[model samples]
Target: MSSTDTIVHILPPLTNQAQVDETYKSKNVTINTQEVTDRPVLRRDNTGLRNFLADSQDNQNVGYDGEVDTLRRLGRFYNWILTFSVVTRYAFYILPVATLLAIPLSIFATIHKESNIKGIKMMGLFVWLEIVWSSLWIAKLCSKTLPRAFRLCCGVISAGTRKHSLMIKALEVPLSIVFWVIACWASIPVIAAFNPETDVTVLGSNVHWIRSLQKGFLASVPVACVFLVEKVVIEFITVNYHRTQFSARIQESKRRMHLFELLYEASTILFAPYCPKFADDDYIINTSLLSTVGKEIQNVTDLQTGTPIRIFDNLGRLGTGVTSVFGNIVSEVTGGQRVDSKSPHAVVSWALERRPASEALARRVFNSLVSEGNDALYQKDIERVLGPDNHHEAEEIFHALDKDANGDVSLEEMTMIVIELGEGRRAMTKSLHDVDRAIKALDRILMCVVLVGAGLIYGTFFSDNFFKNMSLYTTSLMSFSFAFAGTVQEFTGSCIFLFVKHPYDVGDRVEINNVDLVVEHISLLYTVFRRVDSQRKVQIPNIVNNGNWIENISRSQAMSEHFALAISAATTFEEIENLTEELKEFVLADENRRDYKSDIDVEVANVGDMSKLELKINLGYKSNWSNEKLRVARRSKFMCALLATLRKVQINAPGGGDVAIGDASRPAYSVSVSDEEAKISRMKYLDEKESNKYVKDKGI
Candidate 1:
């Protein structure tokens, strides 16, 4: 018997309630003399094979088109928010200027209606055009302004959907062209009205206003042509540069996955014998079973369907983890808990080791951009960093790094870009610093230009009007000079004071303006410091730091840290004193501590009211161990201990009198206590210091 005649037929699983009649709507021949579709047929032992096939199909369905609907919606929503923010920012500048110009131009049009009809008409039209320009700007602002980061995210999320991209292109390209045309055309009437020689006449007869308007628009034709040519030139170079990089990345990915592809092929061959076939009596089954296997393997190999999604999902998880970790860190720091980023043993390990793991991480980010056996990164290296979906941004970054445009991004080229970027930042900062100088220079130039132009105009045409406003103009000049001098004098002393006396360097712990801060970075003009609690960077001018009572916390290695806790006035002094000693013991026994200043002082720092008194504790630690985070943590621990001690003596409360801070039944004694304990309890153990101290004292 033939293989087709000896075939076994198994019906697919009945996932739905379809009738046998509906299932067998199409004609089907017998398989091994059995009418498979006429009745309920079951595969006795092919469940594993069926499951594998089903899973393969499901995996295959994980394409950008199918999975990115949620991402696309999210992206659109984010884009709208960003667009609104950007437009709101622009409108603040544009609306005022537009209004300023419109009012003056409207006044000009009304006053000079008959005498200078042509010039007045031109001004009126330009005013209307300015309004139109403002409207168009509003429109452009409402439209999405997708930055590189957004583009990268969108690209990653839905690489297949070109819908948003296409829509943006369709809107922007024509809108830009139209706006440019309008601007160029509007400039023409102004130019013509200003020119003395060009009379608006056609065939020796005075031209109509409509004819003049037509001429202005017609004059924009050459400008449009020039604009198109320039755009085309830029597009040509940019498009080619991107295309080459994209192709290189594609080739590199395929090359990298060549071995996997081979393994896939071999698997297909190995599984061919076991692969089930659909037997047909009417035609020969010449097609290989490998086609089905290839489809299954393709699901695994396709980066678009597999890796990008996983990477983004992993990134999301990583973000969540980082946020949770950061929250914990903030919680610990804000509370003045004893624990820190480094415990005593950790600090010792870090200090003695000479290099931390974070250094390696920084190095990897910086150095691993380069590919193997190459001095510079190729397109693939960038793809590995930014991902394959972000060819546009990668190409842009690649071009920026590949300064000579030979397409290879060398390490030196990257370093040079960084240097240039740093220089640019410095230039911007210096420009801000020299704002007074710039204003002075600009003021002088503007004054001279205005005075000279006014003098010329007054002598020639508007002499009567100029003389009428001469006193007003002189008063304005005097006001301007006074303002400029006053501003310069105000800022000069501060600038000199900051530069001359460099009090604090970067990374110093200090209390400036009554805020405890870790100095992150100090620029020439401003000092950047991170607050102890939120980790938010606060930028204060050097002058402000100098003016404020700056207490350098890092001055001495071992300085006393003072913190206060509030308690009910009714609470016994014995309880307060006992709590203080427990806290002191807690502070003294810190294994992570390096300072070892065991001197602890407790006092009533403040008597707020008859209801409460501030319980103050003071301790000293090494300068190295004087991280605000560590201090905050230690404080949190003391607060926790205070709560525990308060729980021992309760006035009246519900829920077993646990002395919870926010609970309805929580004690008034514990009510004002800051740094509520986290839901997750943290238990501090003795560090190397405490262990060694115990060992030495016990003679073990």
Candidate 2:
């Protein structure tokens, strides 16, 4: 068919072909129309759908070009603001130290009555001003968010775009100008007081103008430090302000992105064709549209019912009972939900998840409180377990977890409390463990400071009397006393060393040298253990513990047991090999077997006569199943199953055709440590003993 005829066939014939020709020409399509048609024709609605798609595409493109300028400007402004803010932070750290040093110097000058020096009165006045200023600034910080307080007190926005950023910088100029003016004017008074023309005198002494100016400059040092501090503080506040605003903006952008994606998905779902013409054809619809819709449905339900409902309005209450100002601010900023760290479920969780000694203690406390198979526990029951020092904290935990405020806490409530405690205990244990080092250093330094300060004050006030009264004998006695204190401190130092360096922590099953024990508790001076043999608590000094070989039994995730079986020498090698394979399969089939660990091994343990052939096998299982009683039970069960398998396979012991466990005639026996292993163990023990010489010698 001709191209003209094909076009006519595809599109319906029109009563006015000329109008169709004109429509094609308007759309820039070439068409050959010979003449007008008089036949009445039907028109299909194809153009309607095409026009809709075109308009939708145009709408999506709107405002796209303008967003480029906005993004570029925002990036440049953010980088500039953050860079300046960082430089200001370094100034904050230095200014406070300068102010501190200035205070004593100013006081010393006044006390010595230097020329043109003011009385202690002026020193006190300036110090008082600084104190009041610091206190007020701190009060403002505590009362409001950093950004809000910064804007109010510093007269700056602290964060925003070019115009807004300029406005903030402009607002800060007036205050800065005023501060500089006052600082400069403060020096004029002292300078004029000592000028000959002014004839100024203070405390009945004529002062040189140069001397007055020097004192004036010294006084202004503190004021200038305070000014620098304020400036740094403003920048610090600005940095924080911008960071928080950026975070909020990021969250907003994420939500907008999600919304845009959802819209695109919906459009695709509505516009997509029902079927594809080719296998590799692209679909107009989003592939994940159905999943997105389901997620949206779920999100709507969660928003309507979940914790987020309480977030916006009740967020402030999260910091309700927190004592630290920093703690409160952190809580407020982070939504404050986790402040109740000592609550029952949280504490219990901390114990279990971190597997600390606290877990055992917490469990015992719970069991005692819920005695007689009772469902609930009283607060008093917990207090008894916690003892005096921890009673109040334990009670607070109990009350927080009780939820309904009932005097009794239920088992379910206790479980939840334990779960919540997991995070808290881990954090607290690490903090408490590390705090020893900090406190030790701080105490020694502070003691030295106090002693030196006391000695200086005494010498300054009564040096003549001290020299007159103190003799050679007195000096000798002082030296002996210091030696005695040093000896005592050495012992204390040993305790601190053990606290930080001891290998075994509480709750670990340890073998000290060759003696087995469970660590009951750990203290600075001693480690208390529960003897495995007698179940008696034993307290050993830190020095003694440090002198022993320490081993952690429960630390390994998997445990292995070795068995050497005696097979009848009369049995053929084929029967022995078949039996080994069968046992291997049997052990591997056990539910408790560790998949990641190497499978059970079966091999000849020793070369022997045909009458006493031996097979050695190694079986490893999950460590939790290897506790003493359970381990024995598991071994017995496996042995019985193995003997039964041997009988099924017709493998015989020396005496008869039946398989018998623990019979010398049977095919297997338990294996002990080999000679090589024993030697290595002995050497390790010796090495440990040698390494522990410091602790042992100190104890001696």
Candidate 3:
């Protein structure tokens, strides 16, 4: 290859910066920031009732610090929340100033143009709004501190109340604001009536203005209800999205697995004590050198008296594992579950172990892309390697790497897209892609409902103009919506399939209409599929699946397939019994026990040809049939074992081959040109048999 054509994905030597970066990196990773991001993986579930009550990080992309994990799930947050931060920056400063100006203008106003809102009444409204706004901003600024201070003062920081504080934090600010508003409202009339309505002209004239202030504050009462609804919605999101038991379990599992891996890494380091400690932190204290010095001191102590220093025994145990003091410290520190990620054990393991593993993984990923050299990889090459069953993933990876949209993908492009394909594949199995979309979307949908419902409530019971016009517009809109309902029937059906039925999710292998297909993507109306037979992307409405029988292979466990064969009638019943014994033995073996269930059913299913007897077999796989490689291997091994057993039993085929096998009507297996000589011999025999079957059958 020319120098310009060389791959750009060379792994630079590890440095201090790379080491620092590795310390913070989690094993669960994602690819292109624009396409796929590392959203929290959650188990699929339905929990509407629970959704009515919490905002939790379990379902949200929250970090150890309890902040939204913007580094990972920013896509969902930005897309779902309607943000005009940029637009508001220039316009926001005028709002409070404009309201204050209105208050001053209201003092001279007495005109009412077809409305009850006179200048004095408007003045009351402005004062009321300003007070409420002031209270709200104050509450926001003290929200976190108030919750913490309350919990601290109440002595509720123990493990039992750790989870309870989440709810307290959610309620404290809103409740405090509501209490202050009611206080201002109730105390208003008292202030106006103070000094017994003194005969002094100043005090008597002020009574009218005090009454205006009361009405203004009274108008602000409904704001409390808004806060209440906001609290409820946050709780609802907790139950349904971030803190659902389903999502919580997944997150806990990730943390537990991480802890286990960290423990193992620490154990490995301690097991090999001879390895020199390279860490400056450990060396600064002279922990390793202390042990070495202690060993030498004990050996050479008191040379004139020829006595060893007994203190060396105590010093030697300082950093070394024994009943393992150091090991216990490492485990205790590593196992310590805190909101912070800076565990001492983790730091040691990352510096010594995981960094290398991470680097090795990166090199493997790069090598997979450039192994053929430069830009030799193409769309066809990926499809061929992944196989037709995985055509969907192949297409995704190929398209992601092929930045120019050229037919082929180059080495440089692969540098961007290849990251944790295994983890991504696993994420799909747990319905992560579907669940993540729902986490960000379900709240938005619910919020729209909350808003519309709130509007109707206000318009009907609160507003004179809205009450008169709302009923007519609501009915009119309802009528108009129904008229177009047929156009969105598919969408409605899709919602049912997703939020209700949920038979299969993205990356699930499903069988529809006898064709096995892998789900590539799901939209509201249609689902995209890639056929196992290499057919192109097929887009079908999800509604169609409801009416059809969908064999969800990914979700189903311990799946089995049928095997049938015809044997010559001359082959004794004893031979069939011998074949059953062999099949039983294959499944029961120590190595095969994990692969196949012991209940192997073998029976003479039919005698369709009269001259032959049909042997039917069913072997159940012991696990989920999702791993195609393992499934194929199990079937292939069983078939070979069965065929070898048939030969030992001296069984003959119905069509005259000495060994009984699959029916003659079935397509004969052929070896390719590049196949091994053993397979070629079988192919040669099959060809010769076909050529002289008539003569062989007649004993010519």
Please tell me which model should have the higher TM-score, number 2 or number 3.
3
Best by lDDT: 3
Between the candidate structures 1 and 3, which one is better when assessed by lDDT?
A: 3
Query: What lDDT does candidate 3 reach at residue 209?
Result: 59
The sequence of per-residue lDDT tens digits that candidate 1 reaches over residues 1-700 is 4221221112332222222223433333111110001122232332333233335655865322221112356766655555556556676657777887787677756775433454445564555567556656644543345333345678887775454454445345444555555654545444245335545432221446645454545544444444444444334433343344234544543342332223222323333311232111101111111122333321122233333111111222233334445647867866744322212222221211212222321222235456658776676666565667867656665554554444565554444344433333333334333433433443454455445654445343324476777788889888789658855554554444433444554455777767778766655356678997688989886556656777776544445567666666665677666766665666555332322355667787776755566677775543333355555665566567656755654421222325567667764553433353432222223354455564344664
List the global CA lDDT of all models: 0.46, 0.47, 0.52
TM-score of 3: 0.49
| Each model's total of backbone clashes | 14, 23, 7
lDDT of 2 by residue, 541-643 (tens): 7666666677777444556778877766666778777876777777565342322133667777775765676778787654433145555766787788778
Off by over 4 Å in 3: 1-130, 138-259, 270-434, 454-458, 461-471, 487-496, 505-507, 519-542, 546-548, 588-594, 655-700
lDDT score for residue 82 of model 3: 30
Instruction: Give the Å error, residue 258, model 2.
Output: 23
Taking every candidate in turn, the Cα RMSD to the unseen true structure, in Å, is 26.9, 28.8, 20.5
Q: Number of clashes in model 2? A: 23
On TM-score, the leading prediction is 3
TM-score: model 1 vs. ground truth: 0.26
